[model samples]
Target: MTFRIAILGASGYTGAELVRLIATHPQMEIAALSADRKAGMEMAAVFPFLRHLDLPKLVKIDEVDFSRIDLCFCALPHATSQEVIAKLPRDLKIVDLSADFRLRDPAEYQKWYGQPHAAVELQKEAVYGLTEFYRDEIRKGRLIAGTGCNAATGQYALRPLIAAGVIDLDDIVIDLKAGVSGAGRSLKENLLHAELSGGTHSYSAGGKHRHLGEFDQEFSKLAGREVRVQFTPHLLPMNRGILATVYVKGDPAAVHRALEAAYAQETFLQVLPFGALPSTRDVAGSNYCHIGVTGDRIPGRAVVIAVLDNLTKGSSGQALQNANLTLGIEETTGLMLAPLFP
Candidate 1:
């Protein structure tokens, strides 16, 4: 019972990542690959690391035979995904890796993305794809929206604490550092080696980052109020990973207990022992999120740190995890690879 899968926007970072993971999957086959600009080119030309495996040649989205694909991973960019997905077959299961359908409210989407959602009805049907938190919904959904890399890292650190009522929701703060790959494969002046290699700088400060929409939506829903966390993202001089340092007002011991208990049974999420901290290098290239908790020098405060590969666990891996559930397969299938280390 192999599942035939189609990957739209196959030339991008996340798209290439999906191909890398699915190539070795026991029950999944890459039947089609779509990259409008790269159509007719072999994937190896775009991502040589994937050259070892035999795969379908890239094609345009309209050229893909959707009727043969059991599932489609839409790795297209934000605004572009809505237009493409709206025209796809309604019954085909989809895991969208873009920001298109992540926000349930179209008005919220417009507020953050600067435009009204083109597929409001589809947005209504899409389930938020935080695999551990929304397992049941993802298992029954036809469309699942993957969270932002930064959003996923922060939530893995705070969701449990918020759910247990162990933290002060009013004073939450998140400082995240992300690798260059999270920006995608597009060329940018700041991403050049001469500009990015030597130092780090913050962008989207002052509550302007688009992922704040996700934080507001998910956190508020959990606490049953409008919980807004102060967030600032920094660009690190690396190629892959995200490290989020979260500050919360709570009993440090209780924060550790809540996190350990919540992720005790999760296969891909690891909660380190209290007082221990996590590093992005520890979880690089794997579908695993490592979280550590420690008490602040000031009483009644705690710092929760989480790290994961921005390309793997943050986006493509999360998408595949949800796809497994949507197809009624084992959730850990094709996603148990260990982190790469020197």
Candidate 2:
């Protein structure tokens, strides 16, 4: 039973990635593709790499026939997704790959995103799409909100530690580095080859990064208190992947055991051996997050490093995983492909 799917914002990096992964899926088919700017153009025209496969021509969101779409992956930009999703059929199962619905609190959403949510009712009903932590909720919900790529990476490293009470809640710090592609395919002065390549710089420093809203919301909920981690995101010259170097004070062995126990059954998350670190290159182009733990040279502290392709495990792949559950398919279905290697 193949489910018919529609991908909104199909001309973006994550949207093309969804097309790439679903091309090989056994129980999913792309019935519609929407990219407002690229409407009337073939997907191959926007992404030449996808030319080998036959796909629907890009169209406007309203052009899609919702009655024929079993599920919709909304990969549109943050502020735009809420408005677009609000008008979709109420019965349609949606997996939003934007920040619009991630935070449950309307006040928090406005605080971080700089605008009040247009669809408050939908925002309240949207389930957080961290598949590993919210699998049950996701399986039974009609709307799922994908976490930020950086937020997802950092959570993979710290969630278990927080749950196990193995780390100091107030002292956590997350220093993340992300590939250029995570910024989206939009034109930016800083993302040019001359400006981006051969150089790395940090942005959203000093706890100003928006993903901190997620860390605060999720980590606080997990610890039963307000837990804020100092988060700083750096832009790497590469095209994909995210590496979050997390600093925490805890028993290294206990942290390792907590993560191992938490994700032992998870198919997409891997915990490397202690003292061994992870690299973004290893998990590139796949729905896999590799985590490593090591004690800091200074006693009573540990370093947790997590790496994954921001475009894959961090966004589209995560959306697809939640969509499978919403459609009553196997959670891992269509997502078993191994990490891509050079």
Candidate 3:
């Protein structure tokens, strides 16, 4: 049975990506699309690349008949998605691409997002949507919350190592560089071409990033204790991708073995041969994440780098991956597009 789906916030980068991937998806159909600000406009006019697909005109969320949608991709902004999704029919499956439901604890959500969760009951039921690690839970969940793009990158490098006890628990350090699109489609002074070009600066430095909460939650759960890693994100001038270089105290060979074993059967995640690292350009525009591991110059330590398109694998693609599981569809359908290289 083909599933009927809706893209709730169709004008954003993540929403456009969902349309691109789902347009050709064999088991899903786009039944409704909403762009509150761009209601009544053709999706093609808002995103020219999507012009070729035959899709519904944009509508406001309230105007759509959600009862007909088998699944919905909530690509709305952080706090906004929570309010909108809370009122959605409970039986409708949802994959939320926002910060609202990522953190499981209600208190932590408020601490990081500066507001109480509007729908605590739904928040309690939401599954963390890291497809490779949480596939079992996702397959049975009604609500799935996508991870932070930065958090996803960091976890890709560290989660397996932590689970296997291959890395020193206290010394983990994550330095991430993300392209401008990871900041979203919002307008900001710093994202302007003249300002962002030729220079990169760290924002939310000194462990101030909200994604760290995710790192702490996931890592601590793995090690069965509190684990905090230093994470600082830099905004690069490019349009899409994330490169997270992680430093850990572990045997390099063990690091490679651990990641390889964890992802051997996974379709979207690729572990590069040892000593050969991946570039953001290698994964741009695709759902694939390329990870490489090597011994650091310092003995007893290893450096692992992971690359992915922050907009795709890091956000919307991950969203769809979880949606596939929730709806009992193949995980990699319409997600097989190769990375673009120059």
Candidate 4:
């Protein structure tokens, strides 16, 4: 019951991550690997770190023969993935790591993304790929849209609380700090070693961040009302994790209990002891999210902090987890690697 996979944008961090994990999969193999600019080049040329493994040479997406791919991980840029995936085989199973199909509403998609979906027909068929909550749906979906790394971290820490009626929806606030790799392998003046290595600053503040759309959509659905949370994300000087600290009005004890109860059975999600907070270093380079809960002096308020490697658990790890489910394979397959510690 081996599943053959193709990575449509295999040169980026997330794409390479999928390759790294899938290489060790007992039941999955790389059937195709695409990177337009890196086409005809060995993966080692693009990412020297990944040179150890013997993998298919990178090819252009247009050259991929879908007939040979059982599943495709669409790691292409947003807006771009929509058109690429639309042109793909209608029957090919897909896990998109772009914002293209994450929002079910085309209107919402257009509003935040500033363009109409290129594949509204297929968008309607894509399921949100949040591993813990959407496991059942993912198992049956022909196409699954992976969530934003930041969105995934926040949701993991709070969705269960919202579902269990244990938090104040209107009072929620989220502040996230993420490593530069989450921005992708592209070169940006701001991301250069000179500028980004010495300091951290917030961008997309005052509710300007696009991922808030996903948080709003998911939280509102679970709470049965329109809910908005003030979210701000900052870029850190380092290179591989996301830490989201969420504050909400709720009994801290209940917050802790709710999260514990929700994730008690999950192998990749870890809820820490009460009053403890998690650090990005703790879960770096692993498909594990360490969440901590604390009680506030106000008694009815609490703070929750979550951490995970943005490129791993936040993206590729989640993709691999959903792929495992979709292929009817063990959900934890090829994803049991321990976190890379300091």
lDDT of each: 0.96, 0.93, 0.92, 0.92
Tens-digit lDDT string for candidate 2 (1-342):
999999999999999999999999999999999998789999988999999999999998888999999999999998999999999999999999999999999999999989998899998889999999998999899999999999999999999999999988889989899999999999999999999899899998987889989998999999998888899999999999999999999999999999999999989999998889999889988899999999988988999999998998999999999999989989887788878788
Stretches of candidate 3 off by over 4 Å are none
Q: lDDT winner among the candidates?
A: 1
Locate the minimum summed-lDDT window of 10 residues in model 3: 333-342
Candidate 1 Cα misplacement greater than 4 A, ranges: none
Task: Kindly list the per-residue Cα lDDT of model 1 for residues 1-342, writing each as its tens digit.
Answer: 899999999899999999999999999999999998889999999889999989999998988999999999999999999999999999999999999999999999999999989999999899999999999999999999999999999999999999999999999999999999999898899899999999999999999999999999999999999999999999999999999999999999999999999999999999999999999999988999999999988999999999999999999999999999999999999999989995
Ranking of candidates on TM-score, top first: 1, 2, 3, 4
List TM-scores for all candidates, in order: 0.99, 0.99, 0.98, 0.98
| Clash number by candidate, in order | 0, 0, 0, 0
User: How far is 201's C-alpha from truth in model 4 (Å)?
Assistant: 0.3
Compose the digit string of candidate 3's lDDT tens values, residues 129-194.
Answer: 999999999999999999999999999988889988899999999999999998888889888999
For model 1, what is the C-alpha lDDT against the true structure?
0.96
RMSD of each: 0.6, 0.7, 0.9, 0.9
| Candidate 4 per-residue lDDT over residues 252-280, each given as its tens digit | 99999999999999999999999989999
